[model samples]
Target chain A: MDPDRQSELNALRPDLLRFARLQLRDAGAAEDAVQETLLAALTGSHRFESRSSYKTWLISILRNKIVDTIRSQSRELSASSLADDDAGDDLLDDALFDRRGHWQASARPGRWGDPEASFEQQQFWNVFEACLDRLPAKTARVFMMREFLGLETEEICKETGISSSNCWVVLHRARLGLRTCLETNWFAGAGT
Target chain B: MLSCQRATELMSQEQDRPLSLAERFGLRLHVLICAGCNNYRRQMAVLRAACRRFGSLGGQ
Candidate 1:
């Protein structure tokens, strides 16, 4: 690889690692996935079409590593998740809603005012990433599987060893958590 | 009428599966009355769209 290409690859490590860490939820495994992805990219550097292949190409490679690790980790994954959440995803949800099942006085959702405009803003993406990171590990994993990887709900159920309803609950909590997080950290107070 | 909590759940689940007639009815009724749940529902949709965009954001 040219020195410029080598430097470029090095720059992508953090983004790739962040993605792996969230998907695998095990720091060591996440590290290994990123390492493998880098190695693959380095060896297959010739395959890249040049100019545009940077993180997009690396992400595709990383996705494979992430899915592979998830498959192998399936047997052990069940230990962390349950048919109903005991993983504290609901702990926050419980507090956000009153006993009457209404939004609390302080927790109501606020208008985001055309969120698409913020997509071009780096600060918005930063807040989005922070919100994703705030989710419980299990909740984040399930959310990514469905929303990021586009995995079917049944596929996620099989992988996580949880029931369909449980899977829905996890994803629900993730959406709620992320929505509230984005609101508090970005939309509601960002003066959007 | 569905509670805000239950309405939110239905909205979330609708992404994964089609809501039954009763669920649709309850959510439609609840959302028509409650501004908070309506906002929550819209935010969840925005959240989903943002996630799709965010997934690719790492690529750059």
Candidate 2:
């Protein structure tokens, strides 16, 4: 590969890996997917059409690779599932709401104070991602699949082997957790 | 009438699937009366929109 091309590809690795890890939640698998994507891009460089930016092209390849990883994991017999099978539903219920079915004072979503403004600043995503990392692995994965991958709820339920209601519960918990996390770590901390 | 918690749950669930008539009514009523639920609904919108923008950003 040409020096400039190689350097550009190297620079894209971290973003690709973060995307893959968010989906796969396995560092080794994420690394393998990124490596494969880079190799594919290198060989397929001649196919570039310039219709989109080079970074966009690279991310398309990485997205497919991540999907393939998810597919393979679903097929494997006992592929060491990382999500705890016994993650009781009541855990979030008790933590987030009271018996009267209201948000516990500590867990309620606060007014984020100019959240749209935060979207303009690059620093907000770093804080957003840090908050994302704080969620339970499976919850974060489900949320990203819906919000990031644009997958249908049925697709996520099928891929993750969970019921539709269960998927909704996970997504609900994820939103609540992310809202609180961003409030505490980003918006509130920023005095917003 | 839906409680704040129930209203919020329906709001989140609405993103994933269609709500039944009862749920739709309950959410509308609760949101109309409760500023907090209304704000929560808007925040969910902001979150989803941000997620979409981040997906396009590729650097997310």
Q: Which candidate comes out best when scored by DockQ?
A: 1
Best by TM-score: 1
Model 2: per-residue Cα lDDT over A1-192, one tens digit each = 777778888776787888787778789999999999999989984645553478777877787787778877764212134245226447766876799887687776667777667888878888788878878777777788888778898887777777788788778878877876777777777645
Model 1 chain A worst lDDT window (10 residues): A76-85
Candidate 2 positional error at A188, Å: 2.0
lDDT of model 2 at position A78: 23
In order, the first chain's TM-score in every candidate is 0.83, 0.80
**Model 2 lDDT, full chain set:** 0.77
Residues A1-39, candidate 1: write the lDDT tens digits.
778778887777787777777677789999999999989
lDDT for position B53 in model 2: 73
Each model's RMSD to truth, in Å? 2.7, 3.2
- Pairs of colliding residues, candidate 2: none
What's the i-RMS of each model? 1.9, 2.0
lDDT of 1 at B36: 89
